[model samples]
Target: MRTRSLTSAAVSAALGAALLAAPAYAADGVPPGQNPAATETTNVTAGSTPTADTPTGVPSGVPSDAPSATATPSESPAGDPSPDPSSSAPAEGTGAPVFGNVGSDPSDAGFLTVAVSSDSAITEVSAKLTQRHGAEPATVAVSGFTLVSGTPLDGVWRSPRMSQLPSFGSYDVTVSARDSDGDDTSASGVTTVDVEPKPVFADRSISPAVLDVEHTHVKLSGRISLFDPISGETSPLGGKELGVSAQYGYSAVTAADGSYAIDVAPRLNGENATSVAVSLSFWIANPDGTNTYVLVDSKTLPVVISPSRIRLDHSSVRIKYGVKASSSGVVEYLYGGTWRPAKGVAVDMGYYAKATSSAAGRFTLTYPYLLSGDTSFTVGTSLDSYLDDPYLTASHAQFKVDVINRTSICFCTSWLDAYSDLHIQGSMNGSDGKVPPNRKLYLQQSADGKSGWKSLGWFTVKSNGTFNLDAYVSVPKGYWRLYSAGSSDYQPGNSNSVHFNRTATRITGFNAGPEPVRKGRTVTTTGTVQKLSGTKWAAFGKQRVYILFQAKGKKSWTQLGSVKTDTHGHFTARFTAKQDGTWVGVYLASGSYVDAESYRDYVDVR
Candidate 1:
C-alpha cells in the first residue's frame, strides 16, 4: 500500500476528536490490539524527528482511533494540545473533583462563587438552581462560570450575575465541576431567598403613660401589620405571636384585626432611672423548618414615677415643760394629677420617732418633753423595698414646738416682825423633768397686780430647783412676784403675786398736866405721833390719837377722848378728870402702818 502523508493540522484534528469521544476507562481492560505496557514508550518514540519513510502526522505503529499517551500539554510535540469543546475525562485521582467553598457573594447579591480542587486540570464548573414551590421543584441551569485565578484544578469559580431571583423563598443549589480528564463532581446546598414583607407596629400606646405606686401595671396595645417592600403596600397581619420586653418579659397574640394588648409590671431597677426601654420582636418560620427572629420596630418609652407628699395638721405647737408633744399627718402620692393615700409605708418622724401609715394613710408620732425653747422637727417618708412598683419620691415637712418652765413662790407675813427682813422661798421646775442649776431668777414688785412692775433683785437657782431670798424692806407695802427668764430649753415663767405690809409708828411727848387738880376742871392731853422711817422717827401727819383713862385698881383702860394730829404730829384733847386713873394716848393702825401709843400718866381728883 502506498503510505499516506498527514499534515500537522490533520494530526491535531484527529487527536482532539479522539480525546473528546473516548472515556477515561473503557469497559474492557484496554482497547483491542493496544499494549498497555508500551503505551508510554511508543508515544515518546513517535514524537522524535520524522524519518523519510514516515510523515510528521501519525506515528507509524499507532492506530487512528487510539488516544495520545501525552498527559500534559508540555509533553506534546504539537505545542499545547487543544482541548475538546464538547467533553473531557476526569483527572487521575481517588475520586471526582472536591468542591471547597460554594455560596453567594455577600457584597454582590446576584453573584455566586464555587471553589473546586482536582488532581488534574479542571475544564468546567457550573451550578444548578432548583426553586422550591408547594409540591414540585423547578430547576434552572446557571452556567458561564469563570475561574478566579491560578490553575483551574485548584481555584475558585464565579457565576454570572443572576439578580432576578425571587425573595422570601428557599432555593436548592447544586454546583458541578469537571476536570481535564472529563471527571465530574457535584455538591448540593440550600440558599435562602428572603424578599418577603416584614412585620411592623403602628399606633402603639402605653396605658397609664406614667408609672406610680398605684399604677404599677402598664397596658401595652398596638396594631401589628406587614410592609411589602416590592409593592410598597401595608396590610394587617393577624394570628402572630409578638414578644414584648422591658423590666419584665411578656407575650401577646394579635387578634383577627391585627390588634394586640399586653400587660406588664415595670419597676425601677436602679435608684436613679428616668426612663426605660420596651422592645417588640417578630419572627417567621423559614422554608427549611427553622425559625428566624426579626426586630421589626422598636420604641423607647419614658418612665416617670410620682412623688410622695407629707401633710401635717399643725405647723407649730406649744406645750408645758413636762407635757408630751404630738404630731399627726397624712402621707400621699401624686398620680394622674390627684393625690392618693400611700398605705403600708414607713415614716420617719423627728426626735427618733417612727410610725407606719394606716390604711387611710394616717400616721401619728409622739415625742418626749422638749427643752424650754422652740425646737425644729421634720417628718419624712421612708423607702420600702416591698413597694418597689409605682415608686414614690421622698418627701418631708418641717414643724416647731415650744416648752415653758413653771415657777412658784411662798411667803408668811406672821413671821415678818416690824423693821425685820422679808423672807421668800419657792421652787422652779421644768416639764422636761430636769433641774436647771445656776439659773437666774428675778424678784419683781408691782403697785398693781397687772402693770408697772419693778425688779427687786436676782437670785441663782440651786441644784434642787429651789430658791430662797431675804430682802430688807424700805417701803411699807407693795405687790411682789418671782420671775424667771427662760433658757434655750425653756420659755419665760412667772409666779403668783402677793402683798406685804410692815410699817411701824409711835406717839411720844404725851403729858396730862395739872395733876390731881379740880375734879370737874378740864384736862388737856398732848402727844406727838411719829412713824419709823428707815430706823428714824418722822412726823406722822393726818393721824388720829385717842386719849384713854383707867382707874387705879381697874384691869382695863377706857378712852377719855380722841384728838387729831397737826402738821407737827402733836395731838391735844380735853377730858374731865373724875377719879385717880392713868391717862394715855394711842394711835390706831391703818393701811400697813402699825398702831402708836403714849405712856400712861397718873391723875388724882380730890
Candidate 2:
C-alpha cells in the first residue's frame, strides 16, 4: 500500500487562527458544528496512513520515539460492545494489542483516528464514545473502521464519517481490537470538542413594541443566519423556530429566507408594563435520522397598558329616611385614544355595598337611607383580572347623598284654673324613632287656618320628643298649629291646626241674705263678675249677670231673674224665698263671654 502523511500541525494552526478572533454570535438560531459544509472529508487523507509513532508527520504532544502502551480491558465490567463482522476466535499465548497516539480529527470533529499493533493478526477494531459528565451517561459505538497502514497486525485505522457530536464536552474514548488469536485489547483516553463560533440572528424586530389596552398582542419578527469559521462569511439559516418565553406553547417557523414572524399575547399581571423574553431555536438532523432541539438566541421585550376611570350620573342626591336610593354609572378604560367599557368587573359602592358591571360597563348601586345626615358615596375599582384584560391602575368617583328624617308633632290641650296660665302639650318626633335634644318648635296661630299665620310662642323639644308651654292669648279664639323648622339633616314639619275658644267669665264672693232667710221673706243675692286678663283675673264692668234659685228637693235650678253688673263689677238681686232651696246667681251666654255662675247659699224656711 502507498503511504500518505496527515498534516496535524497545519490543521491545528488553521483552527486556532479562526477561533482566536471569532465574533460573538447568537447561539440559539443555528446548530453549531452540524453544518454540512464543515463535515466534508476532503481535508483528510485516505488509505495507507503512517503510524502515530513515525518520525515524520507525528501529531502534536506525542513523541516519535515513545513506546506504545499495551491495550488491556478494564477490571470493571463494561457494557456490551457493538458486534463487528471482522472478529475472530481467541488464540492462546497471544500478546494484547499496543496503542499508539489516539486523538480526534482537528479539522472535523466527526472522525476518530488511531494506531494499533498486535503480535497476532488483527481482525476487528471498534471505538466507544462516552460523555464525561451529565445526569445520565451517554455512549455511542463507532465501528466499520478502515485499515490505512502497513499490515493487519500493525496499522492505522479511521472510523466512518459522521455529523458533529450532539454536545460540547469532554468524552471518554475507548478503542478496542480483536486479533486472530482471539485476544482482546482496549485503551481509554479523553477528548474535548467546542461548539462552532457563529452568528445566529442577523436582524430582529418587534411590532407595537409598547403594549397598551388597545394592543394586547405583540408581533415578533427576525432573520436567522450562520457564520462560516473557514471563510469568515455569513449566510441565511432556514427551518428554524421562534418562541416567546413568556407565552407557553407559542412558536413560529422560519421561511426559506430565514425570516420568521409570530404573534404572542403576554400578561402584565396587573402592572402598567412588563418585560418578556423571546428565543430562537432550530432542530439539528443527526446521522441516525433523529433530530435534536438546540436554542440559539434570546431577547427581552417591554409592554405597557392604559388606565381606568369611573363615571357617575349624579354628583349629589337628597333622600328621606327609610327610602331607598340608587346610583348609576359606568366603568371605562383608556384605549386607542378612546374610552372603552370595562365589563364584568367588581365595583365597590360606599357603605359596604358592591356591584358587578354589566356588558355595557354600567352598574347600579342600591341602598336604604338609614341615617339623618350627609353621607359620602364613593364608587371605584382597582387593578384586578376582569374581562379580556386586567385594569392596570385603580380609579374611583365620589358624591354626596343627604338623608333627612321625617318629623311629626302630636298636639293636645288641657284646662287649668281660670286664674292660672293656659296649658298646651305635644310630642315631637321623626321617622327614625328619635327626637333630637334641644330642637326648637313654634306655636303658630292663623285666623282662617290657611293664611295670616303668626307665631304665638316657641318651645324647646326634650329628648323624648315631647314639649309643652303655658301661653296667654289676648284673642278670644283662633286657629293654632305647632311648627318645626328643619335642620341640615332633618325635614321641616307642622302639626294639625285646632280651633280654640277662650272668652269666658266667673263669679266670686256671692251671698244670699242673713239669718238663713225665713220662708215667704225677701232675700238678696250679690256677687262680683271677673274675667281673665293677661294671666290674671280682673273685675269686668257692664257685664250681664243672672240670679237663679233652686228648691232643695229639685235636681235642677230654676232661673229666677237676671241683673247687670255696675261699673265696680258688683251685682245684687232680691227675691222671695218661699221654699227651702239653694239660691245662686248666673250670667247668660253672650257673643263675647260664654257664661258665669256664682257660689250657692242655702235658706232655712220657718
Candidate 3:
C-alpha cells in the first residue's frame, strides 16, 4: 500500500475536520490509536488492540467529539463493513488483492504494470479490457490472476498493437486475481490519453498545368505538399476530400500521395475552352477534444485552346490530303454547319484531313466527321467564345467535276454524249480555246472497248503535269487510260495527248525570252526550239518567235529588233550600232517550256 505519515496533531485535526465536513456524520470526540498518550506511551503489541479511550482528541484536549479511527471490524454495524478509518489489511475474507496503474496512449505500444498480493496462495489471475479503436484484445499472459502470500508478483502487461489508433479519449482497465482457494480479488482504474495526430498534407500546385488537347484527352496532374515532417516513412492519406472544377463539371479526389488527377474534354462544337480549379481538405483531432483541418492551396491554371489548322497538300477540293498542327489554343471546325471531329475528312487513298493543335493546347472532340459546304470554324482561348463576339475565320470554294472518258479517238457524237454543266466555282479550272493551262484533265472510258476514247473534266494539275486529279470520270466500265496534253495551239499541231503509259510528255519548246539590243547597231542572232512542228504546225495557236540583242555580259541583253515567220514558225532579229565593235547576240523564243534555259549567239556590231 502507498503510505504517507502525518504528525499526531495534524492527524487529529484532520479527523475532526473530516467528521464535521461529512454531512452524514455528527462527531464529538476523536477515536483511539491515532493520537500520542499524555505521558510517554508504549507502542501497542501485536495481540493487544487499541481501547475505545485514548489520548485521541482535538487540539483543545477537551475530548472533542469525532469519529473513532481505532475500532474493531466486529464493532461495525451488522451491514456496514467499512474499514477502521485507515486499515492496512483487506477485510478478513476479501481474498487476494490486485493492484496496478492504468495504462495510457494505448494507440501506440505502451507498458502496463500489475502487482498482486494475497493472504493465502493465489490460483488464477486475469486483466480485462476491450480492444477499442482497432486495437487487438490483450492476451491472457498480460492478464492473469493467481497469487501466493508475501509473494509480490508483478505482471508486465502491454496495450495491444493497433492498426488505427483513435484520438485522445478515456479507457478503462480492470485487473482480477484469484488466490489458491478460488477467492477472487479485483481492482479497476481509468487512463485518459491522446493519440498522436497522423501525418497529413494537401495539394498546393496547379492541376493540369500543361494542357494537351490534340490527343482528344486533357492530361491532368498537380503537386501535393506535406506540412508535417515526413522522412523515409510515409502515411497514406486515402479518402481525403479533393475537388477539381473546370469550366464544365469535372472533379476528382487525391490518391495516397495527396495527388489528384482528372480529364476534361472541351466541347468541340461552337467554342473550345478550358477553365478550372482544384481544392482539398481533411481533419485531424486536437488534444483538447477539438478538431483541426488541413486545406489544399488552391490554384487556377489558364487553359489554352488553339485553332486547328486542317492542312492539305493543296487548297483545291480534289487535291490529296496532308496533315499539320496549328498554333496553341482550342479550336473547333464545322462540317455542313455542325461540329466536325478533330479529324476532318478522308480523301483519296487512305489520306485524311484533320484539325490539329500545337503543343499544350486543349480541344474536345469526337470521331470521323466532315468539312463540306458553307461550314464555319471557331477558335478561342477564353470560355465565353460562344457569344456573339466569337473569334472565327471562314472561307468558301466551288467545284465543277466531270467524268473521265476513256477513248483514243475524239469519238464525239457517234460514241458518247458530252456532259458539261457540272459547275462549282473556285475549285475547278475552266477551259478556253485549245486547252486549259496546267489544269487537271479527266477522261471517261467509252462503253464499247473498240471506240477507245477519253474526255476532259475539272481537276488539279501542276505546271509539271503531276496532279491530284479532283475530277470524277464516269466510264462505261471498260479499259480506260489517263494522260497529259502538252502545250496547246503552239502552232495548232503540238502533241495534245501524251498517254502517261506511252511516255512522259516531251519538253516540246524549251526556249528563251525576247532579246533586246540598241537601235543603231547591226546585230544578227539565231535561236532554235526542240520539237517545234507537228502535223499542222501553222494551226497551233502558240507560235515560236525569237529576238536578237547586243549582250554586254552574262546578264546583260540590250534590245534591237525581233522577227517572226509568216505562218512558217521561224524568226530572226537585227540591230545596228553607231560604234563598230564585236558584240554578243542573245536569242529569245516566244513559247518556252523550261525553267531558266536560254540560247546565246555571238555577233559583230561593226
| Candidate closest to the true structure, highest lDDT | 1
RMSD to the true structure for each prediction, in A, is 33.8, 26.3, 26.5
Q: Give the higher-lDDT candidate: 1 or 2.
A: 1
Residue 363 accuracy (lDDT) in model 3 = 31
lDDT of 1 by residue, 340-426 (tens): 888867776663777888999999888743445558788877434443334778788987887655433322111134655655565
Q: What would the TM-score be for candidate 1 when compared with the true structure?
A: 0.31
User: Which segments of model 2 are wrong by more than 4 Å?
Assistant: 1-34, 37-125, 130-141, 146-171, 176-187, 192-211, 214-272, 276-301, 367-369, 383-391, 408-465, 469-606
Candidate 3 lDDT (Cα, 0 to 1): 0.31
lDDT of 3 by residue, 188-305 (tens): 4322222232232222344456343333444455433321111112244454554433444445666765566656553333344344443333334434444443343344454444
Better of 1 and 3 by lDDT: 1
At residue 574, give the lDDT of candidate 3: 49
In model 1, where is the ten-residue run with the lowest total lDDT?
Answer: 70-79
For model 3 the local lDDT of residue 258 reads: 52
**TM-score of candidate 2 against the unseen true structure:** 0.39
Best by TM-score: 2
- Model 1 segments more than 4 A misplaced: 1-187, 190-205, 208-217, 222-244, 247-261, 269-272, 280-297, 303-311, 319-324, 329-347, 351-374, 381-395, 403-433, 436-461, 465-606
